[model samples]
Target: VESLSFFPAIWKGITETADALRLTVTGLSTLFKGVDLKETVSGPARIADMLGTTAVQSFSESFRTGIINMFSFLAYISISLFIMNLLPVPILDGGLILFALIELVTRKKIPPKVLYYIQFIGLAFIIALFCIGFSGDVAYFFNNFRGIQK
Candidate 1:
């Protein structure tokens, strides 16, 4: 009975975390499908700016609201990152899982040279994504700044 007391809260957290993961997956799929890449994709700078804006607005409303909102936002970001890190890209955890699975099935290890090249490709892909996100952030800020000037 004592241990069961925390079940409801634990369940709620699990559900909410799953929801965040789903949202992150959906967002990534949408972006990859090129539905609104330029408008939706954001880099670290853009995310920070948005976070700051949200914090200001929420705190202006109420301290409690601000705290809740900030924590929620952080959780969402954390979940998104977790999902992304699990993607089957060579440099990430998912890539490691993929390699392990392949080795398990084939009963052999992947060559070091092959792994190196694959990781290089993954690095390139990550760099490309970073560039895209950074460019989007620059464009977003520039447009907003221009709007302010006008």
Candidate 2:
């Protein structure tokens, strides 16, 4: 009941703020672009372009920019993966740690039945979340492709 009551106000605030921010950001971006500054390309495109140009010129011209960007992205992803694995949640590295700690303290292993049930629930939840995210991604791509076609 409390959440239901708060939903409208919370949603309204978010919608209004997002709309205002989008407009302001878009206007600022256009203003900046009009000044003829260096154009920004997508990361993959930029990396490919750098590699292609450098490779054609000479092997000595190390594609420093692409290499640096790739390493930076890899580092960020690695850190994120580590952090996510460390989360104190079930069916993850954290869950294994939790079980180990329990065994150490209680001097008894968790029953196999309980462990199986916990893993089952966790797997179901993960599958549901994956489906939701995959559906959203597919819908977004389909809509964008349709718009491009028209």
Candidate 3:
């Protein structure tokens, strides 16, 4: 992104991003339906395990396919990251953007006290989410482990 200073570079990026977003949205549309959401939103451990399994399977198919598969997985992950960062949480880039938009429209700087509270809320929400994801991951791992032991 830093290297893309001019029009062509920026335009290409925008277009490619649109395509990636479309692909990602299409793939994950069901996740947003509020059905079995805990199972849907995987944590870091599950994500890593899935990726490792994919890489191994792809490599089993052949070296070229493995490379292509890894790149495709990365593209999807990149799209997910982009979308996640844009979620309107106060600690994320989206929150900063929201403040900027507000300042633009209101022609007044947001109160420092309000910003502090908002950030605190965001921090709390983030921590809660991390705890949930971590707990889910641990449960998932133990479940798999138990099945193996049986």
Candidate 4:
């Protein structure tokens, strides 16, 4: 019961951090002039010329589209966060509920060792997932850069 109380705090912190990041990116976008950071950043003028448009117009439209898309992207991200936080796995809210139900039925506290192991495994899995995603981002950047160079 005591452990379950922490889930709300954890979810709140994650949501706050995500919101902060979104705000920071939004702010930074306005600071740049005639530049589209999300558009590969490999000579925007050249790319715009190749695509048959002036650099300024292309950048302006890109920024506008990015701003519009961000709202929809945030909606999906919020949904994903809510769903993931509610999963029935250790170190998650559903997991806490499961533990509480077990304790209620069996009238025995789950051993601390087992709980610790479950959390450790979950943390490791999450770390591995992050690494994989980071690698994919790196690969995507390199691929896009190579394409632009050609």
Give all TM-scores, in the order shown: 0.91, 0.52, 0.80, 0.52
Model 4, stretches more than 4 Å misplaced? 1-69
Candidate 2 clashing pairs, residues 3+ apart or interchain: none
The digit string of per-residue lDDT tens for model 3 on 1-150 reads: 134558987797688778889876775687567666456667899889988998999999999888877876877787888887887899999998999999999999999999999999999987877777788888889999999999
Clashes (backbone N, CA, C under 3 Å), per candidate, total 0, 0, 0, 0
RMSD of each: 3.6, 18.2, 5.8, 15.9
Q: Tell me the lDDT of candidate 2.
A: 0.58
Q: Model 2 over residues 1-150: C-alpha lDDT tens digits?
A: 123358896796577556655554554467346542223212333435545555555434456655644554444434544655655566778777988899899999899999899878777865664565456555555776899999
TM-score of 2: 0.52
For each candidate in the order shown, give its overall lDDT on alpha carbons. 0.89, 0.58, 0.83, 0.60
* Tens-digit per-residue lDDT, 19-124, candidate 1: 9988999988887675756688789999999899989999999998898789889999999999999999999899989999999999999999999999999999
Query: Least lDDT summed over 10 consecutive residues: which range in candidate 4?
Result: 40-49
For residue 48, what is the lDDT in candidate 3? Answer: 91
Q: Which pairs clash (backbone N, Cα, C closer than 3 Å) in model 1?
A: none
- The superposed Cα distance between candidate 2 and the true structure at residue 59, in angstroms, equals 15
Off by over 4 Å in 1: 1-7
- Model 2 bad stretches (over 4 Å): 1-62
Task: After the best TM-score superposition of candidate 3, give how far the Cα of residue 127 lies from its true spot, in angstroms.
Answer: 1.5
Lowest lDDT sum, 10 consecutive residues, model 3, at: 1-10
Ranking by lDDT: 1, 3, 4, 2
